[model samples]
Target: MSTPLSLDRIQHAPKALLHDHLDGGLRPATVLELADQFGYDDLPATELDALTEFFRTAAHSGSLERYLEPFAHTVGVMQTAEALHRVAYECVEDLAADNVVYAEIRFAPELHIDGGLSLDEVVDAVLAGFVDGERAAAGTGRAITVRCLVTAMRHAARSREIAELAIRFRDRGVVGFDIAGAEAGYPPTRHLDAFEYMRGNNARFTIHAGEAFGLPSIHEAIAFCGADRLGHGVRIVDDITVDEDGTAKLGRLASILRDKRIPLEMCPTSNVQTGAAASIAEHPFDKLARLRFRVTVNTDNRLISDTSMSQEMARLVEAFGYGWSDLERFTINAMKSAFIPFPERLAIIDDVIKPRYAVLVG
Candidate 1:
C-alpha cells in the first residue's frame, strides 16, 4: 500500500538537509538586486523570470561547466558582508517555509574574500544571518535551525588554510569543513593535509566526491581522507552488479562502504543535471536505500536545480514509489548523520522529527 504524498503534504513534512550550497541556491530577485548594488553587469538576464529560466537551463544543460556557470553571478554579487548576511538569512527563510527543521549549508570562504572581508568576517556575517533567521522563524511560529560549513575549493590551494579556519570557528555556528569544486583533474587527495588536520583536531568534514567522477573519488574520500559524509556519492553505484533477475552483487569498495555505514549524501535532481545520473528514475538512490547504506536525500542547489527538500522527496516518491515510511527513514538518516552534538541530534529525532512524521503518517 502507498500513501499519496501530495505537494501540500510534502511541503508540510519535516525535513533535514545535509548537502546544500549557499551560492547555488540564491533567490533570483535577490541576485538581481545584489548585482545592481555591486554594479555587476555580467548577468545574462536582467529580468527576474528570465534570469530564473536562464539558471534552470544552464544548470540542466548536462555539462558540469554549464551547470556551474550561474554560481559566477551569484557569488559575484555576494562579495559583501551585507549581501552574504542577506543571502544566508533568506536561505533560512526559504527552507523554513518548506518545513526544513534542520539544515547544514556549505560555501567556500575563499570565494567571498574579493570584497575585502576577512575569512573570519565572512563566517561571522553568515552566522549572524543564520541566528537572525532562526529568531525570525520563531516569530512566524515556525521552527528552524541552520549551521554553516566552511568549504575550500579542491582545484584551489587553500585547503590547509580553510581547514585551520574551520577548526578556529568550530565553537561558533560553523559545524564542519568541506572541499568542493571540480573533481576530475583535481582529486580530493590533493587536500589530504586539510583532511588530516581536521582529523587531528577532531573536527568533522564532508568531501565532494563520486558525483561527476567515479568510484576512485569515493574510494579516496572514505579510505584516504576519512570523510564523515559524502557529498553526492552516487557514483558508488558503479561498483554494484545487478542481474536481469534482480540479484545484486556488491564489489569490494561497495561492500566496504555498506559495511562501514558511510552516509551517502545523494542529490537526485542535481545528479541528473550534471549527468551524474541519467535521470531520476535511473538514479541509484533506490538501490542504495534498499541496501540500507546510510543514504540521505539532499538538495545540492535549490535555485540552480529548481528544487527543495519537499520537491526532492516528491520526485523520489514518483520515481521509486516511496511512501511516508520511506520519507521518514530518509529524514531520520539525515538527522542521524548531522554534524551536531549527539544529544542534540537525538533531541531533534525523538522530539521533533519523529513526532512530526507520526502525525503526518497517522
Candidate 2:
C-alpha cells in the first residue's frame, strides 16, 4: 500500500454521514441572525465571536444536558417556517462544502411545535429547505443529498406519533425514524410501540443507544426494539475483554453485534464532548474496526463537536494509523447502512461515492 494520505486531502474526499442532529449542527451566524429576527434575547452572547465561544464552551463542559443548551438557542429561532428553511438550507450548503456526499440529518418535529407549527408543517418547511439547498448546490457543481430522520424525544410519549410522521414524509424527503434524548431514564423499550409500528410497515429506524448509557441500552435497542442501525453505540467496547497475551475475547453481546452486522455510528469527537469516551485515544473505534464490526465514522454534531466528516476521518487516521483503504471501507460501511432504498443506495455508491474515492486513492 502507498504511504498514508494526509488529513487535509481527506476534506476533499467524498463521505457518508448516517448520524447527525439537524439542530445540533446549526451555524453560529445563522443562530445570531435568527435570534435577532425573532427578538429573542436569551442568547448567552450577542456578538458572533462571543456566541461561537459560548457554544464551544457549553459543548466542551462534558455534560450532556449542558451541551444541549445551544439547541435551545437554535430551536428558539427556528420557529418560523422561513427560519427553519434557512437553517435547513444552510445545513446542506455547509455539508456539501465539507464534501459530504450523503447525510441523514435528524431532529424532533415535536420540538418545533412550540412555534405553533404542526408536525407535518414543520416537515414540509425542512423539506422545502432541502429542495432549495439541493438546487443551490447543483449550481455550484457539488452533489449532496440530505435525508431527514424524524426523531422522537425519548422522554416524551410521542414515539408512535413521530413514527407516523416519518412515514408520511417518506416519499417526500424523510428517510428514517429515530429515538433521541436522555438514554438512561428513557429506554428504547419505553417506545416499543413506535418500533413495532415501524417494523410492521417495513420502515427503517435507528435508536440512540450506548452513548450516555451502557450495553443494556444497546441490547434493548437491537434485541427488543429492532434498530436497523445504532446511534453512538460506542459503549459496546465495555463488552470486549483483552488478555495479557493480546488475545481478544468479545463478550456475548459484542459477538451478536459482529455476527448480526449491526452498524455502529461511532462519533469520536462527539463521544469525547459528551463524556462517552475518556478521550479519542481511548475510543473503541480502532478496536471495533479491528474486530471487523460494521463500523462507520460520523460527526454527530458538527457545531457542538467542532467536527466535519473529514475531521472525524483524520482523527481516526492519526489515532489508528488508517490509510486510504481504511477510509474507503468506512465510507462503504456508511453506504451499506444508510436507510435509503436499495437501488438509490447502490447508485450513490457506484455512480457518485465510489468514483470520487477512486480518483483520490488511485
Candidate 3:
C-alpha cells in the first residue's frame, strides 16, 4: 500500500476553498511594496521577513479580536484600485499554485474606500483582477475559477448597502455576500435588514458564527439572519456531548446543522491561532466529520496562519490519520457547499476533484 499522504502529494490534489479572506492572505513583499508606494506608514516591520514573522506571531495571540490586529497593515496597503488588482491577482496565483481548482474569496468593500475608490469601483477592480489571474494561470496549465463574496462588517451599519453591492456584482465574478467581524457584541442579526434584503432578492450569503462566540451566534445566523453557510462555525460542537464510551449525544442545534446538511467552514490552523479550537489535535473536525456534520476544511487566512489548502489538508491528515478517501470527501464537501451554480459545482466535482482523488484513493 502507498504511504500516508505527504504535503507534496496533497498539493497535487484538486481542492476547493469556500472560506478564504482576500485581505488576510497578502504576500509579505507585496504588502511592503504597496505600503511604500501608497504612503501608508503603519507597518510594524520594514523588512519582509520581519513583517511575515509579525503576522505569524500576532495571529497566535489566542483571542479573535487580538488576532485581527495585523490586518490594519494589509488593509492600509490595499487602499487603491491598482493595489487591489495586484493583491487579487497574486491571491489567485498563490491559490492556483496550491492546486485549488475553485475558490470563493471574501473582502469588505467598505474597508477599501479610504483610498477614495467607490464601492462599485472596488468590486470592478477585483473582478478584473480575477479574470486576468485566471487567464494567466491557465497559460501555466493551472486553470482556476475564483468568485468573490462582498463582505460587510457586522459592527458597521453599511451591511444593507454592501448587500446591494454584492448583488450588483453577481453577474461579474461575484457569487455571494457575507458579514464578518468580532462576533461577540455584533451579532449576525444586527444586520437583519441586509439579510432580509438578500433573501428578498434571492441572493446567497454566509455568516461568521460560532468561532469567537457560541451557539447563540450560530442560532441567530440560521434562524433569524438566514445564512446559507456558517463561516468558522466550529463551536457547533458545543451542542454535542461525548461520553467516555465514545457515545455522542447531539443537542438540538447540532442536530439541525447535521440534519440540514449546513456546511461548517472549519479552519483548523487559523482556529487554533484564534483560540477557536484548542489545538489541531483537539479540534472538533474529526468528531464532527465522523458525526457527518458536512464540515469542510479551509485556510481562513493564508498569511496570518502561514497556511494553504494543501497545508491545511496535510495537518488534518496527520492529526486525524485520515486517508485519501477522507481527504476526497472533505474536498467534495467544499465543492458542493460552494456558492457557484449547481451545474458548475457538479462539473468541477466530476471533472476535477473525483478524477484527481481516484489515483490517490487507489
The digit string of per-residue lDDT tens for model 3 on 1-362 reads 25888999889999999999999999999999999998988899999889988988987988999988889989999989999999999999999999999999999999999989999999999988888999999999998999999999988999999999988888998899999989999988889999999999898999999999999999999989888899999999889999999999999988988888999899999999999988999999999999998999999999988999999999998898888889899999999999999999999999998988897676
lDDT of 1 by residue, 1-362 (tens): 45567877889889999999999889999999999989989999999989999987887977776788789999999899999999999999999999999999999999998989999999989999999999999899889989989999998999999999998889888889999988889889999999999999998999999988999999999999999999989899999999999988999999999898889899999999999999999999999999888999999999999999999999999898888889999999999999999999999999999999899878
Backbone clashes for every candidate come to: 0, 0, 0
Residue 313, model 1: lDDT of 95
- How high is the CA lDDT of each candidate model? 0.92, 0.89, 0.93
Q: Which stretches of candidate 2 lie over 4 Å from their true place?
A: 1-4
Candidate 1, residue 178: CA error in Å? Answer: 0.6
Candidate 3's clash total is: 0
**Residues 58-107 of candidate 2: C-alpha lDDT, one tens digit per residue:** 88867667667678887888887888899899989999998888999998
C-alpha RMSD of each candidate structure in angstroms: 0.9, 1.2, 0.9
Q: TM-score of predicted model 3?
A: 0.99
Which portions of model 3 miss their true places by more than 4 Å?
Answer: none
lDDT of 2: 0.89
